[model samples]
Target: MAEARRPRAIDLYSGIGGWSLGLRLAGIEVVASYERWGPANETNFKNNHHQAQTVDIRRLSFADLPDGIDIVVGSPPCTQFSFSNRGGNGDLEDGLEDIVTFLGIVDHLKPKVWAMENVPRVAPIITKELESGGRLHAFSHLDVQTHILNLEEFGLPQRRRRCVAGNFDMERLRAYASRLERLTLGDVVVALGQDPVCDPLYGLRIPKAQLVDHDPEPALNPEELRINRANKTAHTVYNAMPFPDRMERAVRTITATCTRVSRESIVIAPPETPDCVRRLTIRERASLQGFPITFQFYGATYAQKLRMVGNAVPPAFTYLMGHVFQGTDAEALPPLASHAEHLTAPAPPAVLTPPDRPGSVFPPTRSFRFAIQSLQLKSGVRFELRNRFADGQTEWSVDFYFGTSKNIIALQMDHALRTRLVMAIPARLRREVETALAGVSTYVEAADIENMQRVWTHKGVGGTRPFMLLDELDQAGKGLVEVLQSEPEVSRAVVDAAITARFGDDRPAVGLAKLGRNAPVIAAGLLIGSAANGALRTHHLRTTGRSPKTKSH
Candidate 1:
């Protein structure tokens, strides 16, 4: 009998080799990696991956890629599409460039399997691009799937809601994630046996804040203290972020940065000194992110190290994903803990205590259609573009609600409930919250709120079960708020594209933009022009030997 061959793979935007590490653990050989900003520090991709290349993907040759590659995985930068940076209003062009660039690599490699991780907001954009004869028509022939998934549901011990899209098995992903015991912030603490103060990684090599033997919370300057003071408004609907982030449940998502004032910051006071607390140490942050204790990040500075850790996809996550890609049964593999006894989750951020509101009608929930998703993803039942165009419904209007988690939940109200919902708010918390919003004033009107698909949390189907969670509703929302937040800019970009196409027509330029927000017909038409297949298309063809499909094709 012959021996089975190990699958070969490559990673794009391979920050510190998160995808590579995970894949290698799953019996896949990560033969090559591409990252733009490879810090000169020793603990980077060059040390970990078999062939880490700092050369930009745009500059690489098809000959540069490893041969016989079977799997491809990458977490393209999410900053441009994330809500935290600018309320999901970052540079769409730059963000789209990275996405298209990633697709370009996939096109050239034409690997057997691939997947991408990004904020939930990016799902629609990619889905729209992959539609029949869409902008990224290259891989439309393959069975690609996109879904907004919570990583915690996959047993990674983090309450990270991300969009996982690719040709990977949806059933296997679901089954593998749940196979391991669901862990919590406390479980992570258990995994990281020693405190940062005692760890070898934390000694004189890291930041002073991380090395402090003083009481946990670092001494804050006066301004930060003023901003962080505890508060209680009769109108306060949110459950307070616990002093030390909770350890029982999965932690909140960590990003490339952290701060004292941000709600997402993980503040923790050691059990012995629970009175005062401090933000997570670099090593602690890495553990929470699912890196083993032995994983040495060779960055020169703590802040730099923090960025590397925060930006990585947990190797544990990729392990399960790799199993599906390689046709391996994840259940037969060892648990995530077996990788390194030092493994720990970014201990969860909050001690959840979901609260109630006065509506008697329904409670809020950040579970689905968060401020951005709710604005964009709206519907349990869907309607086609033609159907929507023919409906003759008036322009959409803005509205608000609190989620069960107390995070602001933006809802696109119906016409009939416009006045009622607005009038009802003064009695609840919206009066104050409305002002907190960046001065939004549009109103949805005349649609029957009672008949909308999102049955209020208080009720379930035929009252048979509590509608505590709406999985499908995750696909809905993003009506007026999304437009209001992204437009003017999006409109301006479209307008700019139109101008370039018209004025530069003689100079070999055409207007094409990928706003990801449902572009206007005229704008969409412009997008379907020559530019979609121009530079990106040429790059794909030059790198790979195949001519990719464009909208014109």
Candidate 2:
């Protein structure tokens, strides 16, 4: 019998080779890692012994990739979708382009298996687009699965909930995931000998006047200092002011934003001396992120190094995921080390401390329906999006949470309600409506938050959880562009058909006079009309090579 061939794979956005290393250890041959960051690329090369390509992925052709690739894994930049950046569901910025490029590569390569790891918020957007049967219809054949996972559940130290979307048997994988022993921050910290030590300043209680001289709480605002002294608020760091990693429970998510200069994000108070808190060292952060001590990071600044570590999917999680993906027996895997036998739980974040709110409840000034309708003005349909407050408290502040809600009306052409509206509009007004809707949607989506402070509180807000719906749209648009660019004849045919059916060949400029200030309404109508019947469907059919009647999995 012939020896079984090692499964070949590639890792895109392979920061420090976290996924590559994990997969390779699980017997998958990770042939190449495509990374644009120079320092991370260097680390990937040094550790993984694979050459890292620094090219823009959008320009990469199928031919540029290695042959016989059985799997493709990517963790596209999650900055725009991350809640920490500018609250959750901010502008797509450059992350949208990256998503487009990633989808293009997947479509172009047609890998036997693929997985995309992103923050949990992005799960819905990814699933929506994949199921939309739009440009991504080509991927409809695979048995797609979406796993909403928290790393702490997998026996890692930090608490990070992420979405793993791919073509795999996730049900079975989830079952396997449930059996892993839970690891706490204390266990790994103790195992690595990161012992707590009393600070030299522990005995000294400096007055507020002398706080500047002591500088123990340099990052605290004047108000925060007042709160610290009066309310005994914990020394704060980052906007979230993460509590020190407790031995018993998991630490909050580690962000790429953790830096020496901006050392407020990942604070750890020594278990022995709670007041002697300090920033987590590189090794501690790496360990918290599940990087083996042997894996070295090479970077010019502490920021760069932290970025690599924070961006990585924990290797322990990846290895386990890879094993499941390859159908390896869960019981046969080596037992994970549990330092619980030897370690004690440390103190968790103070944010987790119970609040002492006055025992009174105020009746709502507005109902959910009324509040939702208030946003549904002629300007644009608005809704109260759900979001977390600065202290990690769940809240529904109208001013702070506008754009993140999936319920907000963005002009969807295929939506049944919108389709009827589009049909009612005269053919002459259809083009104008389409243009106006695009413009209005843009304006509404970009509307200013009435109260910025209410939206960006420190304690209630956490880092982003990967909501990338705009990025999905951008990806779909790119896929459509690719279809048009690749086949000019088909593009022309589709365009002609759209123009003739929608407008009766009446030039687009003809309706400009009537559109005037009503551009938004007309645009909204046109958006629906165009979506219901357009050249996009032609491109989708060609791209997927499936009949309209064929069901997408």
Q: Which candidate comes out best when scored by TM-score? A: 1
Q: Model 2: runs farther than 4 Å from truth?
A: 131-135, 194-245, 259-264, 336-553
Candidate 1 deviation (Cα RMSD): 20.9
User: For residues 478-546, what per-residue lDDT tens digits would candidate 1 score against the true structure?
Assistant: 222333343444444443444443335642221122223434322222221122123223433444455
- lDDT (C-alpha, whole model) for all candidates: 0.52, 0.52
lDDT of 2: 0.52
Q: Tens digit of lDDT per residue, candidate 2, span 1-553?
A: 9999988888998888888877866778888989888878877777677768886776777788888888888898888888777767667546656666666777667778788888886776666656665444456555556778888877677888998888866765666666776666666545444222211101122222311111122233433222233221221111223344355777778787743223235555546456554555555677678765545677665557667888888877777767766887766664333211211112221112111221223222211111121122232222222232323222222210111234322222322333444454456554554554454334323332222222233223322211121222223333333323444443343333333444465635432333333333233223323332233234334444543342110
